[model samples]
Target: MTAGEALAAAAARLRAAGVDSPARDARILLAHAASVDAARITLIAPEDLSPDIEERFVNLVSLRAVRVPVSHLIGEREFYGRRFKVSRDVLDPRPETETLIETALAAPFGSVLDLGTGSGCILVTLLAERPQAVGTGVDISEAACLQASANAVLHGVEARADLRKSDWFDGVEGRFDLIVSNPPYLSADEMQNVQPELQQHEPRIALTDEADGLSVYRIIARDAARFLSPGGRVMVEIGWTQAQDVCAIFDAAGWQTIRVLQDLGGKDRVIQAQMAEIGN
Candidate 1:
């Protein structure tokens, strides 16, 4: 089969499977199978495909046909203009989460902690961007910690970042100037409504709180004060409708100066709060 032939077959299969933008996905996968860029796929799509290349393309199509996330199939995901390794054990990084990084960067901090730091996208990116910063990323899955560590090395920040396996704050110590997270906040119903690629491919523990969707926030809100220094800040990525509820959690936890920021879509997506001092 030629590249064009492979593309046609993959597109047809993806479309039948109800995957959006079948042609676009087909082109990307084809490029990967052919060892070329997506843009270059267009130029040589009519060219003949080797038997080995055709076999690889077929395997990728099979994976995508079953609703596996394209990023997982590709083995890497781009976040904040950098690529991070991803696995079934970690949540794939999304563009919206990059907003969390930008928000954290806006405030100057020497040390950072990334809670629920699946794939290390936020922590690694933060350490990469802020040279003087040292950070640690904590995740429940050991596999995720390994992947995050590998990505830290890939991004040339391994010396400044530590990846560890912990159930939230269980194994973590020391206070940080800034703490951030993109925790699982999707409600059960929300999980059901998620796209198949995400629902089937991504780790459930990294996507939903497995309860009413407030579990992670509750834990983070209550524990953050202990882990953050006086005047330290915490930023969390939240579901659009979750801003007020999350803010209330922080307030109840005694965190002050609670503020929510909106993403590009005008939805309140990040809630930032400062831990108050004892005297004040």
Candidate 2:
């Protein structure tokens, strides 16, 4: 069949399977299968698709219909204007997490620490944005560290970025002017309600801590002060309804300047706080 015909058939199959944004997903997957830019898809003639391209497109559509994330199917995701390789090994970088990057960049820092660094999107982006800065990213999964390392190299910041296999601060050393995380914050109950794409395809350890979702924040709050330089700040992405609880965790840990920042959607997305200067 032709390219347009194949696209229409795939979109119809996706729509019938109850996939949201079926047409958009189909277009993107088709472009990927056909090895063309998504923008170039519209310019191609209906008869441009070869048999192999048509077969690949049909297989991709079938996988997407089963609720697999398009990013996983494509093996990369765009974050902060750059593409990072993604897989089941790391959480897919979401647009909401960009709020953490924006908040971190608003302040001055010579060094950074990214906990649960997943795909290394946050650490690599920061280092790329600030050429003089160096950063460390740690994850519990070795595969995640590998993925993050690859992304750092892809962004040409591998020299300034260190990816480590650690559970939070376990193997991390040195103080940083800024520490950030988008740890698993979903409660067990919330985990039960997530979309199948995330629930089944994404890493569960990166989605929920199997507790109240505040456990990871509590751990960060209790230990971050020890690893932060004088006047160093900590910023973390949180669940929309978690602003108060997370702020309280940091406040109780003696962090000052605790504040919540909202995303473009006006939902609480980041909680930031600073350590007291050494003299104080």
Give Cα distance to truth, residue 6, candidate 2, Å.
1.5
Candidate 1 lDDT for residue 79: 92
Which lDDT tens digits does candidate 2 get at residues 70-153? 999999999999999999999999999999999999978999999999999999999999999999999999999999999998
Please provide TM-scores, in order, for all candidate models, with all chains considered together.
0.94, 0.97
Scored by lDDT, model 2 comes in at 0.92
In candidate 1, what are the lDDT values of residues 219-279, reduced to their tens digit? 9888887888778888999999998899998888887699889887888989998855722
Task: Evaluate residue 101 in candidate 1 and report its C-alpha lDDT on the 0 to 100 scale.
Answer: 82
What CA RMSD would candidate 2 show? 1.4
Q: Best by TM-score, which number?
A: 2
Clashes of each: 0, 0
RMSD per prediction, one decimal?
1.7, 1.4
